[model samples]
Target: MEGFDFEKIEKWWVARVKDFFIGKPFKIKMDLSKSVRTLVRGVLSQAERRQKDAGGTAYVGAVMQHLVGAKLELFLDEALEHNGFSVADAPTKRNGDFQIENVVIHVTQTPTESLIQKCVDNLSSNLSPLIVTSHKGAISAENLADAENIADRIDVLEIEQFIATNILEISRFARESRKVTVEQLVEKYNAIIAAHETDPSLSLIIG
Candidate 1:
């Protein structure tokens, strides 16, 4: 996959081995960053039971950053990679994200023109992508218009939505393969991705 999470390589995040997930996506992100900033300040964020300063201090820049970082690391990394999708940013995966065959993911908190143009260029170059945004609020009119203009440029799927949508398959594959953990499933899939990506001739063993 093109959008190999930089963490995937850095932290030995071979998917299932050391991977972690709470019942909620926000919590997972908070755990990864060790901050509850997003929970306090986000449009729909709520503090976990453990955070003492998580209240009344929400809506600060740190909060948004909390949301962005968590959303990117927890949900974005897990969901996209599980599907063997590539991100634009790999090795230095933050620059873009993953590339799965034709699909790519560009993680962001807001959809900027520079980002959109990059997506356009990538798409024209034959990379299908989705924009992962940390903006939990409804789409702005401006964003809506731009999104329409380049709807085909790249997709934009929220991090939370993606996890809820795919956790089932994650669970299913884990059970089927006797991996017994999300980390294991992720490991299997990512290995499959690297193998097929590096040598299409090795496709037979991937399944």
Candidate 2:
């Protein structure tokens, strides 16, 4: 009993909890006929379903965040720094989730008033704030920006289109190339999840 390794047991228990929180990699079918935005939404919808199944432990935010990170890495042709899902911007002193050039990108499933304030803060620092969220969250972000009197300064976009448009451009607007583009994105997304997240279930699988 004196040599009991409580810390090791605690780590093992936490890992098990995270595994249950995100049960499996959601399977998404790739179809050339489907618009890239539609495909992206399908992925997010699967994340939503998994979250609900987990009794609302909230993994959608992480899914969206990492997807955005993956897309940016591929589209921008550079590696971006990745942080774990639960890490807050304030603690990390990050301008946003990802920053490139003068643009500060914030990815979230739910847009809050605090986020609006962060956008304002970014503006004061002469950096453009781009908010990437779900379609409904985009509306909420816009409304929040208006309430804070910074609607024009902050750009709010749905993550589906944000990721989709880049994929189209990266694939050179060709249909066949789009599939390859998506496959690359999935691979990058899975790699990011492996490196930055403890939950392997957050990894996505393509069918």
Candidate 3:
């Protein structure tokens, strides 16, 4: 049947749907200790599974971005605010996935030439540019920036490395038992999203 594996794909979707439904109805408080444990487990599990499937790199990349974004929103926002900074989700028309103060973070599964150009555009607009891509894509991103003669102006970081640096406790707990439930993780994530909804600092208005 050519490159098709209907049965395997079906099973994958079924498992994902089941997990979604099973984890949908529960709620928990925003306990950073417990939530970080759950987030680490979930991100690793999802990344491992995605990396093994066809076109898995793209899937893993998207998942990594979401996970990273969640961590930034839930855990790092307070610290940013404390330091007189804030992060906001960038709109599609924006150059990056997130705006952290005057810096724009462009997250990609792979750092293609187009994405690099976007970073350059951000730089021209007087916004600092940060590229976050898969570990394998980090080198390419850096090279592209160099080619564009903007390497010194932009920063490239591997997604995993960023997580490790910003969420050291979670990285350490990734090896431990899964003490937190998926339901709790979802609740914590939702809390972060809800908080952002009314956060004036997160607002991005463009004329």
Candidate 4:
């Protein structure tokens, strides 16, 4: 007679499921962070206000497009995978953006994560989330340690490291993304040169 070993059965079952998905492709699920959504709204509102004051046109669609960095998030997942880390892409409609096996990864550019907590149960949630930012730099370890429910599981990723790690690949991306000619760059240089006339520090950037 065979012994009723529940732990053995569970391990075998889990192994089989994991094995089934080996080498299988995963999709990028839509897991947009709440903080990102709020920041978008704030920026759009500010833009609208500026436009209204200047008597210019306000386009909501354009604001939405700028806020959603779908491409950046996709690239992040690619980088993580390229480094031998299995990444579960963001879900299409889920509030939590992604899952790396059991761990969750949330992408955002906002400095605050309060809003993100509103969309999902962070503490009770089984998966952890990491905030990815392109602008916000040098996050405090304490602040990172304070994320609600996800404090223990949540962390932040800086864009500088992200770009630095994938600089070689990003060079190719930049080449593919070119839409303007040398003329455009020349004009930009001219403008920068004029700006530098008043402030020497403006010369910090050069082609």
| Top TM-score model | 2
The global Cα lDDT (0 to 1) of model 3 is 0.57
Error of 1 at 109 (Å): 1.9
Expressed as tens digits, the lDDT of each residue in 111-130 for candidate 3 is: 88988888878988999999
lDDT of 2 at 188: 96
lDDT by residue (1-207, candidate 4, tens digit) is 378998999988976765443312211122233222332334345444433543453322222222222233334433222110112223333434444555554444344445355324544556555555544322542264564444455566653344333432533434323212212322332343343233221111211
In model 4, which range of ten residues has the least summed lDDT?
79-88
**lDDT, candidate 2, at 179:** 90
Q: Which sequence of candidate numbers ranks them by lDDT, best first?
A: 2, 3, 1, 4
- Candidate 2 lDDT over 1-207, as tens digits, reads 688899999988977876665676776689888888888888888888778766786788998999999999999888999999899999899999999999999999999988988999999999999999988999999999999999988889989889999999999999989999999999999999999999888898987
| Colliding residue pairs in candidate 3 | none
Q: Higher lDDT: candidate 3 or 4?
A: 3
Worst 10 residues of 1 by lDDT: 198-207
Higher-lDDT candidate of 2 and 3 = 2
User: Of 1 and 3, which scores higher on TM-score?
Assistant: 3
Query: Each model's RMSD to truth, in Å?
Result: 16.0, 6.8, 10.3, 22.6
Overlapping backbone residue pairs in candidate 1 total 27
What is the RMSD of candidate 2? 6.8
Model 4 residue 142 lDDT score = 23
